[model samples]
Each structure stands twice: as C-alpha cells, then as structure tokens.
Target chain A: MSTTKKAHTTPPYELIYWPTIPGRGEFIRLVFEATGTPYTDIANETKDGISAVLALKDETATTSGDGNPPAFAPPALKIPGQGKDGKALVIYQTPSILAYLGNKLNFAGTDEAEKHYILSHTLTALDLNNETHDTHHPIASQLYYEDQKPEALRKATDFRESRLPKFFGFFERVLKGNEEGGGKFLVGGKLSYADTTLWHVLDGLKFAFPKELAAREKEFPALFGSFYGSVKEVSGLKEYLASDRRLQYSQGVFRYYPELDRQ
Target chain B: MSTTKKAHTTPPYELIYWPTIPGRGEFIRLVFEATGTPYTDIANETKDGISAVLALKDETATTSGDGNPPAFAPPALKIPGQGKDGKALVIYQTPSILAYLGNKLNFAGTDEAEKHYILSHTLTALDLNNETHDTHHPIASQLYYEDQKPEALRKATDFRESRLPKFFGFFERVLKGNEEGGGKFLVGGKLSYADTTLWHVLDGLKFAFPKELAAREKEFPALFGSFYGSVKEVSGLKEYLASDRRLQYSQGVFRYYPELDRQ
Candidate 1:
C-alpha cells in the first residue's frame, strides 16, 4: 500500500434526508444534479446517515452545529462556510433550501419582478406537492396509508378530478403566456428553478396518476409535452434522470395507490 | 347632504379576497393591522369588488396590467405606483405576499441568516395552515364541507392529535432556542412577520380545535401565552381584532364544525 495520501475536496453541500424515499429531498437534489454541484448526501452515503438525519431533530444531539436551531424535519442541507472564517449554515424547508440554492446557482431570476414570479411559481408548485402528499396521507402522516384508505379514496378523487386539472391548467396557462421567456421556460428564456420544480411536479404527478394524467394529456400538450420535453432535454438533468440516483417513487409524495387511481 | 368634499388619500395597498370570510386574507390583514398601514380591502368596500377580483383571473378582462401574469388565486394585493410614472404591481400567494410586505415594511430580518430563518418559520407556519385547511376540505376545496364530513372527521382527528402537537412543538423549540433574540419573538427580540404569522396560526387553531388546543395549552405555555399574548397586545392588532373589520371565522380556513372537534 502507498504511504502517500490524496487530498480530498470537501463537497460544498451536505444533504441530510431519509435514505429510503426521494420525498422532498428530490427537489433540492434536482437543483444540485442539474447544476452538477458535488455534494455529500449524508443519508445515502453511510450506514449511520439516517441516524444523523434523525439526530437533527433531537434537541440535545451531539452534532457539530450544536447551537443552531434543530430542523423541524429532515431534508436539511449543511452548507460549507462561505468565507475562510464563516460558520457553516444548516437550512431546511424545501422551498427555502431551493431559494438559497437558486441564489447560489444564479437560476433565481435576473430582475426583481422575475424573481418574485419565480417565487410565486415555486410556492404554487409546493402547494401542489402538499396536496399530492395529502392524497395518500389525507388523514395524517403519522398514520399509515392503509389506516386512512377510505379518507384517501375520497381525497384522491377530488385531487384527480378537480385539483389535478386545475393545477395542470394553471401551468399550461403559464406556459402559453410566457411572452417574456418565449414560452420555453416558466420564467426567462433560460431554465430557472421554477422550470426544474415544475418538471419534478409533472414527473411526480405522472408517476402517481398515470391513467388520470394520460386521460387529460391533450389538455395541456404545451405543458405536459413541449415544456416537459424541453426540460428533460437539459443536458445535466437528462444525465441525472438516466442515472441510478433518480430514485423511483414509492411511498413518498405522489404515491400511487391503485384504489385511489381514477381515469 | 354636505356639499363639501373631503380630500381622499389613496390607500397604498389594495387587498382583494372573498369579503364574507377572513380566509387567507386574514394573514395579510394581520400584517397591515400590526403596522397600521392604510389599505383598501376591495371586496369589503364595494359591491363590484368581487368582479374586480374575478377580472384578475380573466385573460380578456382588459385590465390595466394586461401583460402581467394573472394571480393563481384570490387574496391578491395591488400595489400603487411607487414613483410618478411607475405602474401598479399585482401579486398573490399568501406567503409571497407576506414576504413582499415584510421587505417593504422592514419586518423581514436584519441580516441574511435571519431572513432565511424567518423564511423557514413562515414556510413551516404556512405548511401548518395548509394542513389545517385540509382538515375540513380534505376531499376538495371546490366541494362543500358537508359533502366531506366523513373524510373531514378522520382528517380532523389526525390534525388535532398528531399534526397540531407536532407543529406547536416545533414552534416551542424555536422559541426556547432563541438565545440571540431573548426568546421574546420568533426571529429577533423585535417583532417580525413570522411572529404575526404564528399568532394567526395559534388563533386559528384555538378557533378550530378549541378542546384539543386547550387540553394541550400547558404544554406550550410560552408559545400560547407569552408569544401570542405579546403579539395580540400590539396596539393596532388589538384594535383590529375588536373592530368590525375583523371578520368572524365562518366556513373558512378555521371553521368550527362541532362534529369534527374533540379533546
């Protein structure tokens, strides 16, 4: 064995989320993946990663950042110090993380109005994501989907028949009205965080409600097909999607329950 | 009738929402009330206000801001011209609106870390709010609460027993860990938008789940009594709460469905 040791480059972002499911971490992951930012996924990289994630919620965990506020939930990011003496920043809340990353990555927006526009879209996408999660866990996240099957059935019905079309229609209108961005992306002509966020939304919705989405495919051809096609073709995102890193949707947000599915 | 006409000061902000119920508008209203900012509550002021609100969603409404993107939903704010030749700005999404007002009102945060901390709190509060809304309208917002009473019962149980405590507990931890702010407010010693937002969350929870919240009152004494008490004592908010402008909780976000309440 060689005595010489190779120098290691610290991954700027340290993502801590449940290793099993993609969940909300996927949103932050997509940003990193699309930008090709090297980051350590704490949970995915080590056996003790899940424990590290859970320890974040513990009030007295013996973690490195002891003084920082404990994240209410996981999918928290530990960012490296910006300056030589700056302290590491641990931030959570999916949209907040995305906004921070967007700012760092320069995909936020060029102008004030554009930034707010992107923020509005990102929040709306999150609203849809929340509703999608509720479709499966309508009663509570603490309870199993099996226990709330009846409630889930009713909630999913509304989600599919009414909420799905309404949300998809809104994005379609956004795409059609993209005069400033030439109708290619949600914000400016170039891809912004909103585009990636929306891409994930559409992808998750399709995974969760294939039959229902297929039934209404023609309604938002520009959004579901053209816009999605363009986003999927982004060189970085394309490679990420094809890689094993893109976890399959299981019991996470946008879960598929046969009983809840409708055409 | 008096012949003399009084000079009118244009309200700097125009808030448009369904007038009969507080709904999400109350969040924005609390910010305005706490700051004593003069604003026009459109739907409450005029019979044609709903028409104005609807026109915003109409693609062919021939509105002044024709090229600007329409709001995805109600509770949209219309900001008057800032400069002599500036055009009005229309923006919506409850948290988005709060952020805009927070920046304009200087209640967001003093520094970058503080701003992101405030943002995390605001988003978490909004998450709780969304879940609260779904407790009643788990099936669909478009459908009547009566139609989803069975589903609502199950969801309300989960919300009361699980979600409520979890969210409140998170806020309590945030309050306890505030060494920098002296534990008086969510962000800093002085009030921020997160403080106002949390006040609404507590108020709405008490209104909707009185028995449950009361039973757990002692658990979050600091949050329920001190933080909430302080926020309520803000002069403008105290007056607003007592005034007729403070709309009652009806079939809105925090409706009191007797059947759904439990200890």
Candidate 2:
C-alpha cells in the first residue's frame, strides 16, 4: 500500500524485504537506485510493512486460488494496479523479480538474443550469490553461524581462494567482452543489472574477506576496478550507501568473520 | 545441431547431459520425461558421457565469444528451432533450464504468480540438491568425493539431521497445499517442474541414503509417495529412467558415500 499511497506515483512497486539485512533484496534495490525509480522499501515490515506480505502469503496458501502463488521465498514485488477482480498484482523470487523489472525498465536486453544474454548473466550472478551465502552457513542456515564456525572457516578460505578467483575470472571475462561498448559495462552500451550485481558481490567479498580481496584485488583489475569505481560514482548508489537504508554487513549473508578469512 | 536434423521436429528439445551420473541435469531430464516431450540424450558424445561434460566446460572456460556466458555449472539445454541465427539454442543452469522448459512445455504455471510459485518450489528442491552434493564434496568441488570423505562425513551428518528436515518440510507444505489436485503434486492442478524436481531430490536422497531415507520415509509418507508416484507415472521420465541415458549415482553431484550416509 505504500506504493499506492504515495502522492508522486511515477514508480508503483512495493518491495517486502527484511529491514535488518540487505541480503537478496539489495539486488532489486540497486536496480531501482540505478534507474532512479521510486519504489517503497518495506524494511522490517513486522512493525510497518510485513502485514501486506503476511496477508498475501495466507491468501495464496490454498488450492482454490484464482491466480498463481509466488513460486517461493523473499524479495517479492507487487505492482499496485488492480486485477480483473480489482486487486493487487505480485511476483516473487529475486531472479523473477529482476527479469520482470528488466523487462519493465528496458535493461533486460533489447532482443531475444539480448534477453537470453541478460537471463544467462542474471543466473550466473545468482549462483555467486548463493555460494557467497553458503560460505558462512555451509552446514545449515537454521543453525547459528557460531555453531558452524569450523566448517565456515574451511569454506570461507576455499571461497576466498578458489571461488573468488573463479567468480572474478568469470566477471572479468564479461567485462572484457564488453568491447562493443568501449569495454565498460557487462552488456550492451550501458549498465545493466549484471553490473550492479557484480558491484554488490565485490562489495560483499571485500567486507567478508578484506585481506584476501585486498591481496587478490590486482588479479581482477578490470572487474574489481569497475566494481569499486561504479559504486563510488553511481549517484543513486552513492546516496543509497550514504543513507541508512543500506544495512551494514553484520550477521547477514556475507559476514566479516576474521577467523574464517585466514589463509 | 541434432535438433536441426529432426524432420518431424515436433520432437521435444534436445537435452545435452552426461550419459552417466544423474547430476544437476537430471532436473531438466525429469521434466522433459514428465511432460512426455521427445528429446535426444547426448550422453554418447564422449566415451562415457562425462567427457562430453568436460568438453562443454572446456568451451565455457576457454571459448571467447560475444553474448552472455553460460549460467550455472551444468545441465545446459538446446531448444529446437529457437536458436539465434539458425544455431541451436543453449541455456545453462539446472533451475533456469527447467523453468524455461517448464514454461515452453506448459508445465510451469499459467500466469506470473504460478510461474514464481513453481520457481520457488524448484529452487527449494535445488537447495536440497546442493545439500546432497555437499554431503560428498563438502570442502570443494575441485576435490574428489573420495578426497573429502572425512569432511563429507561431518557435513553429511549435519545435512541428514538438520537440512533434510527443512527442505523436506518445505516440500511437504507444497504438497499439502495441493487441495484441488490431492497431495500428489507440488503446484497447481497439474504436475509442474517442482513435482518432478521433488521426485528427483527424493529419489537421489533415497539412492544415496537408503538406510536414512528408509528410516524417515514413513514420517513423510505423502512426500515420499509423491516422489515415487510422480516419477513412475511421468511419461518420458519412466522411459528415460529405464534407458541407458539414465546414469547411475556414482561420481555425480549426488554420490553414495556410505560413510556419510551411515547413522
């Protein structure tokens, strides 16, 4: 309803994500920030914005539903427009939400080939996201991070050495492939969600394994440079970072566990 | 290229997966089977089908071309007649490929909501798949299952006790929500990719942890039953499972490490 209640209605999307952690929602939030689109971020909705999400979930938890339920999980998006029966429209899953937004925002590749390219890249970044989360919580998410600290140490070290290099290598290839656009962004002539995601991934790694990232930063100069430079320069992203909305890396997906960061 | 040669090309898509080892590709292979689509098993490309996978990775690693790189590690799809510039289309990442095929085959949901719902469920199955893989390769994918036996045992114990119940519980809720279609499918009135994925997840778990699965099977009777019933009745899957293309569980993502499986 925040998206609907707003006076200036250029953007009409409601995002329901955990207020305490940026986690998955940061990807979608970055896209909106980059595009300068207005979307209501219902952070920590239990006190404020979660009621809508809970209601939506309860309504769809049945068989006789008229429409499709969100496939699963958080980072759901809702367009305030009404349906045939005059209700809201919603979609979930970060990839699906990004795809829908890419389609809406025109960053999702212009042609079929481009769409495929965007989709493929999006999925690739998603893999990195999952792996990043698994680095700390490799054993289980329900269990506390402390409970799995030993496994986390081994996993994080491997992630810093093997996984980081591999991912940085992949993104470096993507950046190098951008020869069509003077070799700046990942796709086309301008920035896409892929670029934003790369920035997030790099930022997360830097926070989690600052020493490793600092040591290995020179290896992926192109990707690392573009990531650092873009985050600093992107006006909206700069603002988001400076603002309180961008949650600090704490107990979220990518945590800075010094013990786990050792070589 | 095989798809191009099809005369009565109504034959389903061409799935290029390892001839041996169910691995990640089985997710897509199962859907094609469930939907009764005709697809060629390119398992014979190499001496034992794994070389073919290696060749694909080689292309991913060394090949430099224009367009986004392949997503995820494996289980790429070659859709017939949809390739760009007369080339056979290739899409990677098991979940994305399954969702793409599900959409094309009409096994995905009817609308956006249904599509998200199916994706979420499939993703949870994928999470389960990841845990199964970690049971064998806990330290790193670069290390062989045998090399990581000690780590695998530690990881698997936690997986069986904690992770299994979480994923299984999610599936149970999904199945229980099937009030219109009975508690047999994961989504909507008909079978979706989630159901097939659930089948494969349960099947792989049963194969890898027969003793553990058998002990807990009765506790999740509906989920266990849905796994068997869905795959048995699925059209092409039944044929595929019986054929040579259906690889064994050895050396794949989900391996039978007895030490890890034992209580």
TM-score of each: 0.91, 0.86
Predicted structure 1, TM vs. truth: 0.91
- Clashes (backbone N, CA, C under 3 Å), per candidate, total 0, 8
Clashing pairs in 2: A19-A44, A45-A49, A45-A50, A68-B114, A70-B117, A71-B116, A71-B117, B33-B237
The TM-score obtained for chain B by all candidates, in the order given, is: 0.90, 0.85
Q: B23 in model 1: Cα distance from truth in Å?
A: 1.3
Residues B1-263 of candidate 1 have per-residue lDDT tens digits of: 01111113333688989888888888898888777677778889877898877776664331226344557788788877732147677776887788888878778877666677778888899888888898888878888888888888888887888888888888888887775565558875678888888888789888988888788989987788778888888877888898899898878888787777884
- Residue A7, model 1: lDDT of 12
RMSD of each: 4.7, 4.0
Positional deviation of B225 in candidate 2, in angstroms? 2.6
User: In order, what fnat does every candidate score?
Assistant: 0.44, 0.26
Name the best candidate (by DockQ): 1
Which candidate leads in lDDT?
Answer: 1
Give the B-chain TM-score of model 1.
Answer: 0.90
